[model samples]
Target: MLARTLGALLCAGLLVGAAQARDYRYSDAHLHYVDFFQETEGMPALLEAMDKAGIEQSMISGIPVAKKWHEDEPKRPRYYAGDDADAYWYSATDSYVAAAVEKLPPEQRKRFHPFLSGINPVDKNAVAHIERMLELHPGLWQGIGEVFTRHDDLTALTSGDTPRANNEAMTRIYHLAAERDLPVLLHSNITSKRERNPLYLAEIEEPLRNHPHTRFIWAHAGSSMEIHRHQEKMDFLLPTLTRLLEDYPNLYVDLSWSVLQPYLLDDKGTPRKAWLALVERFPERFMLGSDVVGRFSSLGEQFQGFAPFLDALPEDIAHKVARDNFLAVLPKPR
Candidate 1:
């Protein structure tokens, strides 16, 4: 009778422990402080949402370029590339992010890490522009990008020259990133949503192969919100990510909201075994992101959505994906 009672108590204690662990605080690996359409809720609102969501820190950047209003529609896009005007480099967007960060008290400011995102990645002058921003900001910026290279509709909308990950301009930026020990958060879509083929694989692959020293966080593991909206399933995502993780030590995937569907969880909302195995095999290579743009209310739901997957993981690995892994990749404070 005593043995039975003791066993019951131990089981109860273990369950409680697991429940507590599920509420892990996060260091959001991907987020945007401003949007192309000027739709941000501003800093105080963002901080409140973060506090509610238990996000201890976040990687924040401005949209590097602004989406123009397509003349046929001549209205602001309800979503990314909704009407599809050309995208052009807008440096002031980065300044908005910088000024927002500057407003916080030093103690509060430490919780936010800002990245430079305003440079036109295709322009040869981009290298000089980035260098100028770095010199202007001193130690204020922590990393570079959320750089959009192969976005679904947005890539089609970009005017003049489209940016490619392996372009000579990006090559120079990669060299600078290596020199400064800054990680680059690149958003190059792996494939188009309709085709679901790894069509632009080489764009990101070349940079990974060439710039092995520069830490590259592949946003959404190369998936996008636009893709998620159009396609209910992502068939090729797992194998492609597995190959990349195997091939490149410098590559880390941003498993944000778009990846949660079909990749992380199945139709019934159960964690997929293959993905679990991949996370287990390369536990340090994956990180979580809310991918929230210009707003903050959904932040809690975004982090909470990963609970099922995290619960399936070993406690340590769950904690790492939830928070620690992101902190690990951050540029060490100078």
Candidate 2:
């Protein structure tokens, strides 16, 4: 009897392992190829992480701003938020991404979709900079952002005028994205940490309304790690997204890990029904991302964490959210 009980437990453990194994592939919809310090683990590390994570493809871009190593600081800060040092727009970041991907063999190179993001979103000349990048590497850039606008603490730390999604500079950038057939992944927060309502909603909404032709992937569905840290939840996010989806056809959402907890999944990590319904209503508009900046160790866990939520979704919709949606948003050949 004891032997039979042990055998039953072994079979149950095997079944659990099989259940936990991921069967679907993933296309990381948002990833920073370089960190605020303008560094990465290199392509070998990234490819290895992706291979382990089951990420077949990725949308790779550089952080537009570089954190300054303030002179007064005794120790160099490891991350952007480590100190009050100002970060400035660094155009060389795009080149870093290009260099890394270009060095890869053709097969490996094809796995990455590089986006140009090394521009100050508040600078009107930013669009011109993007144009130059496209000309420099004819068929290289696949999309436009992870453009930092209205980001949490980064807004305060970034040098120069604050960037808004509806600003003239970003407006011009949006037009360029539409013209070039490149989807723009914008990181415009919906609200500040203190406020509950979508206070900054208009910033993104204006662009969505005005630039109907440009595909805009609202990174983290307008939520940020900083904001999530401060507030329990943005109670208004779901309805706001539903309304936005109903109104704008070109809008897409990146389900990065920041959005997974307390919104899509509850405290116990169970998928929330309202959020599931929202995805079900607009299956083609959602995609998953690791949102890992310059580090790859957490890539597998970042994606695998979504398994509970993805499993709750319908099979077809789950597949689209996991991989197909991101590919669908990529720029088409001319």
Candidate 3:
């Protein structure tokens, strides 16, 4: 009789657990990471921050084109036939030869397991970066993203307007993500085109047509600028934000900076209708993000920046937005 009673209680507990995972995971699907040379260091410290904020894991992303490295491709230096064998391998020869070339100045590349980039030609060694990260700490990375597309640089690369370069880079990253079977997080902006960016319409709708299963997420919903600065544009993004939920099944939005979305309304002395619309229209598409990069003031800092947004969320809907929904898109844990 005692054994039967304990077994019954255990079953009850398991049922409730499933309910929690389904309804209240509270995962932050978007985040940025900075290495030693960036604003700050200490990569492993994020584990504690996530634990305290009730955030489970975040999608970590790096810069594809970095300021530390050359934004433009390097011109190959003419080599003389009689030059010494050692000078022939100078890593400084160009951005393509990168750190691998023996005798050359080291660039801003972080030596994570000794990753040096000045000699690593991004185009040729694009696959190598992914390989290095995987090999260095086999399963440490959760997702691949925060990769950005610059309109100016890409236009110069492609020769045509926005579509040419942006599409090519998007296709490149999309193919790589699909090859590795990881969902990508894009810093989708409305400023791609020269005259009329159409901020949301052209960028989001067009890309999905080519790569159907690419698992591309749009950070900030349809937000164009940063929360602190673009306090005005939240109202502008409303119509497009609504359209995203209806059209893009794979697309998701984060509420990381969106507490400011409501605050924006209050500042303008406008009705709170748009805020309610966001909560009601796409509860599943939202997730929390702190957007902290370096050694922030508080420990488990997700709670610090994320508290306002989380508090504004409806209780049951908050549970889904904060956690359970993101697990649907996150890369499977190794």
- What are the runs in model 1 whose C-alpha is more than 4 Å off? 1-21, 70-75, 228-231
RMSD of each: 3.0, 2.2, 13.3
lDDT string, candidate 2, 1-334, tens digits: 9999999999999999898765889999999988999999988899999999999999999999999999999989999899999989999999999999999999999999999999998899999999999999999999998899999988999999989999999989988898889999999999999998999999999999999999999999999888988887988999999999999999999999889998989999999999999999999999999889999999999998999999999888999999999999998877
Per-candidate count of clashing residue pairs (backbone under 3 Å): 0, 0, 14
- TM-score of candidate 3 versus the correct structure, residues matched by position: 0.60
- Lowest summed lDDT across 10 adjacent residues in model 1 is found at 75-84
Q: Which residue pairs collide, candidate 2?
A: none
lDDT of 3 by residue, 35-68 (tens): 2123334444555565555555445443233222
Q: Cα lDDT of all candidates, in order? A: 0.87, 0.93, 0.48
Please estimate how well model 1 matches the true structure, expressed as its whole-model Cα lDDT.
Answer: 0.87
TM-scores of the models, in the given order? 0.91, 0.95, 0.60
> How well is each residue in 95-114 modelled by candidate 1, as lDDT tens digits?
88888898889999999889
